[model samples]
Target: MKLYPIESGNFKLDGGAMFGVVPKTIWNRTNPADANNQIDMAARCLLIEDGKKLILIDTGMGNKQSDKFFGYYAMWGDHSIDKSLAKYGFNRDDITDVFLTHLHFDHVGGAIQWNKDRTGYETAFKNAHFWTNDNHWEWATQPNAREKASFLTENIMPMQESGQLKFIERPQGDFKENSELGFGILFADGHTEKQMLPHLKFMGKTFVYMADLLPTAGHIPLPYVMGYDTRPLLTIDEKAKFLNAAADNNYHLILGHDAHNEIITVQHTEKGVRLKDVLTWSDVLTGY
Candidate 1:
């Protein structure tokens, strides 16, 4: 199996919101903020190539939003999914599966695109089956007031409308090992209800896709949870548990929103789980 990092684009978000109640004095050290107090973020997606199935994890924010919407997010950079795919000699049509960690706009926006005539929306990966779990599907479709803004209908809806949406059947436990995808699935409710983090066995190592649960290496500490999470207290507990497991098993974490760093590993320290090493996708490839 081969894994590729696809950078969809870069955007800026309020550092305060990203780091939650964590003081700016602390998080700013790792993710320095701009003059506007915003920090750089990436809509980095992962592509998994195995056999004839080309699976893409998390489509970054697509370019379909209006200028006003883009203005709010401070979207920047020339990187795009098309160019990134071309870099690997592939295209959107080659993707057979789109595994969404969650339905937030930044994570799932690129899953759907505007049709040729601009009349309506269509699945971005025409040949792909958009994969998300039943619980998250409902949570996003009928979003609560707090998360309603992040779950844009334009970014979703079209996948199901196109008859290409496939919901992953939740097995009879809190976590289910998906043999078909060659990964184990862990459900995290702290960030959002039933956010599926994939524990992929690749290159003789275990790699966990740390969606919003652990947005960046700076969030390695238990208290550095995002303010956007509905349940901050629950996030603390969830993070601690995940970090302990990661440190004990030496799991490499694939970050979704970290603009500068692609992968990281943690170690148990006196203060708690702390960043052990920061690595690029190339480092993993070369090691393999």
Candidate 2:
């Protein structure tokens, strides 16, 4: 199996919101903020070429939202799913499965796009079967007011409407070994209800897709939860348990939202589990 890091695009988000109650004085040292207080963010997706199936982890926020709508999140960079796919001599049509970690716009927006005439929305990966768990599918479709804006109908309903949506059997416990998608899944709820963090076995090692569970390395600290999360206290506990296991097993974290830091490996530190190393995509392909 071959794994590729697909660069969907980059944008900026409020550092304050990204790091929750963690004061800027602290987080700014790690993730510097701009004059307007926004920090660089990347919607990096992962592509898995395993035999006949070409599975894409997340699609990133696509370029379909209106300029006015996108104005909120200051976007940057020329990277797109098309360009990234082309870099690997592939295209959207080649994707057979789209495994969404969650239904947040940044994670699943690129799964659907405008039709040829721009009349309505349609599946971005025409040949792909979009995957989300039953619990998350229900949580996203019937979103609470707090997360409604992030779960846009245009970015979501089209997949189901197009008859391409599928649900994984929600695991009875926090971790499931070798899910239907052929990888272990670590379920996290502090960030959002039933956010599935894929535990992929790559390079003969464990690589966990750090979705909202650990947005960036800056959030490695237990208390630095996101303001958008509905359950901050729960997030702290969830993060502690996950981080401990990640450190114990030497799991490589593939970050989804960090613009600068790509891959991270944590180790036990005096303070707590801290960043052991930051690796670039090239570093990942070549060696440790």
The sequence of per-residue lDDT tens digits that candidate 2 reaches over residues 12-73 is 99999998888999999999999999999999999989888899999999989999978998
- Mind giving the per-residue lDDT tens digits that candidate 1 earns over 226-283? 9999888998988888899999999999998899999999999998889998899889
Model 2, runs deviating above 4 Å:
none
Worst 10 residues of 2 by lDDT: 176-185
**In every candidate, how many clashes are there?**
0, 0
lDDT of each: 0.90, 0.91
